[model samples]
Target: MKTLIVIPTYNEGSTIERVLNTTLEAIEGDILVVDDNSSDATKELVRNFFDTGRVFMLERPSKLGLGTAYIYGFRWGLSRGYDLFFEMDADNSHNPAALPWFLKELRGGYDVVVGSRYLHHTISVVGWDFKRLLLSKFGNWYAATLLGLKQFTDLTSGYRCYTSKALKAIGLEKIKSNGYAFQIEMVYRSHRKGLKVAEMPIIFYERGGGGSKMSRKIVREAMALPFKLRLEAIRHIFKDNI
Candidate 1:
């Protein structure tokens, strides 16, 4: 199947080349970097790889949200008739070596395969502080419980693979959230639509360079999106029953 890895970047110049090269070595597919007008020469660095024909980029005017970046990449892949799509980090936190495992699951008919850090009762995350870890664990629990997605261990995991059909069914253009909430919403929608979702354990490391994009606004959005999704589900049920 034709695969496309979509990496959303902002000031990721320090790590983009390594990530791109490693990803290319691991998988035989195209890569699309949706850059948000990075000031750190990220675009120029990526352009060097464009001559290889396996790498492509989309430069946004400003720092758009992560959700929009992925959405843009998704649409681009869809237009080109890609069979599989990946959401990977450009900062190398998510290992490129895991690409084969994800593709294996995809070939096995899983609609969505997520690289989970909390799967198998083990905390596979490295380089996270206790406070951040606690918040992450609690946040996943809260969102999963409220959204009725008990089967998934990592609702907010960005390292994931989606089949083309699954992406189409999820309605990419309709996605609203931009922060971590975007990840949760995609999984929830896939589960709601009865797509086959699978999780594989992966070690998530802290970025080696560039600052984290996490902020108070992102946290707030993540906290509220579950409630919003749950209410929407309820409304849909009520309307259908009526």
Candidate 2:
């Protein structure tokens, strides 16, 4: 199976090289770095990997939303006839070692596999303070509860793999969120569309460098998106009955 790992990066020069090397070592796949215009040496660092031939980079004009970057990468992979696509972080928060496990699950006929830090009532995160941890837990609980997606333990986890069939089935054009909420929305849409979704436990390490992209705007968007999604589903049901 031809797999493409799509990493969205912004000012992550401090860790991009190591992330690329480790990811390439872990899986038999090509890597695509979707870099938002960064002031740092992130782009320069990514270019250094191009000699490997399996690494490619796409430069955007500016810092686009994370969801849009993945969507861009997904489309790029799809056009190139890739079978599977992955969402990974460039800051090394996501372990590349778990990639083989995700691919195994996909080969076993699952459409989407989420690498979750909280699978089966267990918290498997490190390097986070209590307040941060509480926010993450509460956010997951809030989204899952409101969207009737309690079956998933980490709806907002960005570490995930999806088959090309699953991506097309979920209707990429129909996805609405463009921030962190995008993760929650994708899983919800996949489940609603009858795709098989599985979660595997993973240890999430906090970023070793650079600041978080999380802003008040992103948080607010995440907070309100579930209600919007729920309302949309209800409206769809009502329309069908009419």
Candidate 3:
């Protein structure tokens, strides 16, 4: 089955081309970059790289949030007949060479495969402070506990593979949240729909080229996530009664 990797980018001029080249050379499918109209030369760089197929870009008017970027890209990917869909980090933290493992596992009859950093005794995150690690760890624990999803290790993991079936089950129409929490909510909703999920241990190296997108605002949203997710789950379960 053919696959499409959707990378959402914002002001990644310093690293976009190298990341694209890395993915295109290592993987066996289309890499569609949903650029958030980065103020830099991100869109232009991709456009000039290829005069044709495989590597493509969709330019938005401005920074439209990560959730919307992926949602737009997912819809675009579905329309193109890509049987499998993927979301990955663009700053080289998510290894392009490891992509085949996700596809191979998906072919082995799983609906979704997550590249997890906390599984199988692998603490593969490189170059992170303890405080940042603690924040992610606590946030992930709270999200999974509140939502009752047991399959996901890193609830906010951006590296994942989805069969067309699983993606359809998500019904992007239902997902909320803009950045980090978006990943957590997707995993929760996928579990609710009974999609089979598997995890592959991976090294989530910290981004080497540019500043992280995470901000104080995103952290505050993530902190409130457990309570928010629980309430949403309860509402979804009782929507028919209301």
In candidate 2, the residue pairs with backbone N, CA or C atoms under 3 Å apart (3 or more residues apart, or in different chains) clash, namely none
lDDT of 1 by residue, 77-191 (tens): 9999999999999998999999999988777789999999999789998899999999899999999998888888998899999999999999887689999999999999998
For model 2, residues 1-242, the per-residue Cα lDDT tens digits are: 99999999999989898999999999999999999998999999999999999999999999989999999999999999999999999998998999999987777779999999998788999999999999999999999898888888998899999999999999999887888799999999999899999998889999968878988888899999988998988899999999
Q: Each prediction's Cα lDDT score?
A: 0.93, 0.93, 0.83
Off by over 4 Å in 3: none
| Candidate 3 colliding pairs | none
Candidate 3 achieves a global lDDT of 0.83
Q: In candidate 1, where is summed lDDT lowest over 10 consecutive residues?
A: 101-110
Backbone N/Cα/C clashes per model = 0, 0, 0
Question: Please, what is the TM-score per model?
Answer: 0.98, 0.97, 0.94
Candidate 2: regions farther than 4 A off: none
**In model 2, what lDDT does residue 92 have?**
86
- Cα error, candidate 3, residue 193 (Å): 0.2
Candidate 2 displacement at residue 91 in angstroms: 0.5
Per-residue CA lDDT of candidate 3, range 13-66, in tens? 888888888888888898899988788888888887676488888888888788
